[model samples]
Target chain A: MPSAEEAADAVDVTALLERGRTLATPVLKKAVDRLAPPMNTVAAYHFGWIDAAGNPADGDGGKAVRPALAVLSAQAAGAAPEVGVPGAVAVELVHNFSLLHDDLMDGDEQRRHRDTVWKVHGPAQAILVGDALFALGNEVLLEIASVDAGRATRRLTTATRALIDGQAQDISYEHRERVSVEECLEMEGNKTGALLACASSIGAVLGGADDVTADALEKYGYHLGLAFQAVDDLLGIWGDPESTGKQTWSDLRQRKKSLPVVAALAAGGPASERLGELLAADAKNNDFDNFSEAEFAARAALIEEAGGRQWTADEARRQHKIALEALDTVQMPATVRAQFAALADFVVVRKR
Target chain B: MPSAEEAADAVDVTALLERGRTLATPVLKKAVDRLAPPMNTVAAYHFGWIDAAGNPADGDGGKAVRPALAVLSAQAAGAAPEVGVPGAVAVELVHNFSLLHDDLMDGDEQRRHRDTVWKVHGPAQAILVGDALFALGNEVLLEIASVDAGRATRRLTTATRALIDGQAQDISYEHRERVSVEECLEMEGNKTGALLACASSIGAVLGGADDVTADALEKYGYHLGLAFQAVDDLLGIWGDPESTGKQTWSDLRQRKKSLPVVAALAAGGPASERLGELLAADAKNNDFDNFSEAEFAARAALIEEAGGRQWTADEARRQHKIALEALDTVQMPATVRAQFAALADFVVVRKR
Candidate 1:
């Protein structure tokens, strides 16, 4: 639990994110609009700015966390948030691009309380639109005209490649019965940590921060990303469907080899053995269709008994602390440091 | 139809292309090897450098025409072909990326007489590998360490966006009944012309040629691309399967909106009306599986009678002439000019 001061800081960070979204969204919308039609329409719908019929509609998009980190990092580097808008846009575009492709690859039908892009527009269009957005992100980064634009482009592309590598590994892991905790951590680092690290460092690079400062921020972002994923893995098992906007026990239902499951399997306890047996039986008999609520409840109990839930929760807190320590290496305004710390706390502690 | 002098020029040009393939393939292989497996494996297979079992196998790839153009353009601008190695690698990567995705999008099982990447690997792997190659292209460009590197990156990204736009339009056109000749030409320009134009101009830019010279080469490549497509369209309907490596009348079988088919439909002759009726009936009844050989021959004959075949052939020659004219605008060495002109002729007059 956060202290009173930290709670107030979280509220302040939330407002900062809200402002970041309001300011960055128009820039993002304009960038996406530059895509040729049908693509533009598809992108707009994916961003929740419009409906499938191309009419304006109110839809829930996430808290724009990555973009907020970009802006805050820029501010920490002694530049205004506006100076980081392009970085924000680029990161947001890439984030969406990954989401679009991952949904298709995972056969996910819904996202953010709405149908996925592949579900709504078909897989081919979704794939193409994702490609377009990836290109657009690079395009936007190059258009920044800063001395660091090339550097940023290279950084973003490298991170993107890492992200793809992670996704590919994730897909391959699904077919395997057991994945080590170390391998799971590395995958999460690549899958989720890479982009967040990019987001955290890109603004400082763009703001002309020195290499040391940039490196510190990158370290901060890297740990933050790990913590973020650890928390996300926890939520996948225990999160409220109303809050997560996903089906209950979504990760387990899909047999995802996420952090918690991998950790439990690596634990080698009786609960781990029993959970593995259940999964094997489920796979052999193709029995998920007849799986009962009681069975899901039992699985959850087994995971907790194996210390999967506590392991991930503790890991999240540990990583969060490391993230803050990394941030301490960078010299920034006190207010900016406070906000960054608050954001880190909010990331781990948020229910959704 | 070429004179004796021109025939000699064609042989020299063919040697140049062969030399380019030898030089560029190693560089391309190195770049692709940088991709993590199975992406690396998939890309290597797509390049015909290996087989599905990851063993060396002899597989026929095309003539490496685009990379040849890049090197030759650099030479035309008074730079050694080595100066344009990065350009060659970038263009070839982008070209292969498009081919991988296009094969999947078109449901093409074979390319260059072998199973396509998507057919051999799955669609998911194909899409990801295509994406990795696209990013790799940009990454390779940025590694050039010259002022031109940023400009080259921008040019490549712009052309890639246009290429995607063209593909989206092509997919949509497949569902349409009638499309105008002008629209078809515009689509072709975006689809085929854009990347070829980039390939032609990028080397000159990298070689530090003036903008005027670069623009002329760009025009040269644009026309050459159009002529190449015209020839390809003709071959799709009439070429022998032994040479084309595709089933005879394959485009007609797939109901592709090739240049000749669009022209034949737009001629508004009796043959055009009958051809349209046949297509409409085929689409409405979904009776392509039962389409007879005689009906296929009749469709080809009707397209010829409607002057579609002649019109496209004439257009190919016209574009070839224009391509040569554009080459004439550049004050290249006589030998380089001869080679460029020979390449243009080779594009239009090749039977397969």
Candidate 2:
């Protein structure tokens, strides 16, 4: 295993994430196989290996970060790496389940450089994809338990319900305006937070981490998720379009109710006024559309001056500190501990 | 519990169906809690208790026949009635999940005496309903297993995967025109048969019935589902609209290639000719509005005369015979055994 210094140098978790993706693809493919026609095509499209008409395509599947975290957590907790394979599959499947639905809700037409499932196959097929994904996750979890019948069943169930509960809160936030910063934190804590927690905590449950350690890892995951989101929110607008493969200031264009925007909204001064103007311009496609490079630069400046950027960075740093503290709870060797702690900075400090 | 002779008096299963519905309402309401907003509202409307506005409304939900059968299978498996509540909830949730997506596939506007979830909530929210439902079913299954920690864990994953496989086939069926009889049977086996088998099998796994008995119950469910489909095929064209609450000869109007129709197509006889004519008629109705009552009646007569009705009935009877064989595989009190045997007959004989 890489030490903390090595992990920091590795800056790329690509190989680990790739291994995780490889582990999950077959289990998910089996699920899609049991469901797709001619025993193949649709599953392939979901994995971005084929188009809707069943033609093969070499497409980027995803970073598959969750599955990697799950596998690593299991390995860290003393499970054989193979034991983590099913857990890795379970985490990836659940993550995709949410994405299938999230794309539909947010009206995202593309994901990972391909048409979203709903866009490609229409809503009906998309719904089925999400259904199959969620079912597959549970099936994988049970498969793990089948291998170790003495495992704590309650923990898996509780983790799943927590993930679902977090999804509920995330959806609820869409309807709610004027949410407090604390409430937003709480919402994200459950939605994105619980699942990450589960990725680690399920490892604990399987590897028999004491409740204290499991609870600490759950908090580790939660704080890490918040830090991750804080950085993501900053990148959503200022991110390099080429690097992110998305429109710059994309979240602003969509009027997304993210942390930076919420913080700006609550700050409620020139920042709020400028944010509202940008949103209205977006809604009307007036000055927002067909902008000159200078106009776009000016708009970006207004956004930053509004304190949205600073608030987000501050929050990310704060959460990273919390996440590092939680990492200390794990009984891994000093070298592995350093590697895990570096992950906290990697998440919050990412430029893209 | 009702006796065989007593239930044989052409009694209404309405009360039994209602009991399942009543039990599910609170369970679903709590499961689709505040976190899932439009999803909760969408699921609520699908259950027929809420309007498009999320306000309460008076209307019928589904007949709850699936869940009723689940409970009955558990009882027939000789478990305490209460143990089946989670199974009932799981089955109903899965059924509704299928319906939510099916409505999207068929562009069905109304369901359960109300607008379909997609009709009012858009396909996105409907997708969430289906996703949440599958998740909820797994959640319920895990909870059920928690109570029985050691038992049912191994097979629960298997049973749930079977359902996923079934639904996947059903999804892929929409695009394919060349489903073989055996393939179609396998699909139906997964769709209708698997869940029914799970109902009783889970019961046995939970607390009652030995391995041989569970196998018997599962086989009984398999044939019963085939018989039920046969009856549905019969009703598709010949059913009384008042009783079935479906348009008269609607399946013919839609040119549905049902089991009997598929059988006829394979045979290439008079039934095939009639089926072709019906398909032509459906092709002519660009808006599903060109069918005159007289022409509909003529087509219905053709379907009846060309052995469609008789063939369906024969298939139903043959399947019932198979189901009877399965029932005989288990030992029960003569009176109790007669109960399940009669219910098997009821699958084909009941109207609506």
Q: Give the distance in Å from residue A1's predicted Cα in candidate 2 to where it truly belongs.
A: 17
DockQ of all candidates, in order? 0.58, 0.41
lDDT per residue as tens, model 2, B1-352: 7655565444445555666567656776676563255566677777777777778987676555566555555666666645666666766676677777767767777665567888887775666667667666656656554534234544544555566566667656545554565766677777677666665456555555566777787788777888887888778778887777777876666556566555654556676676665655566557656768887777666666666667778988998888778877776655546656656656778887
Candidate 2 lDDT over residue span A1-352, tens digit each? 7655565565545666676677767766665565445334544687788887778887777556666666666666777545666666666667777777777777888777678887877765565666666666666666454533224344544555555555556666656555666777776776677777767656655665667777887788888888888888888878887766677777766556677777765677786777657655555665555666666566567667777678888999998888778877678656445545656666776776
Assign candidate 2 its CAPRI class. Answer: acceptable
Instruction: List runs of model 1 lying over 4 Å from the truth.
Output: A1-11, B1-11
Per-residue lDDT of B18-79 in model 1, one digit per residue for the tens?
Answer: 87787788889899998876789999899888988889977886866788888888888899
Model 1 residue A2 CA deviation in Å: 16
- Which pairs of residues collide in model 1? none
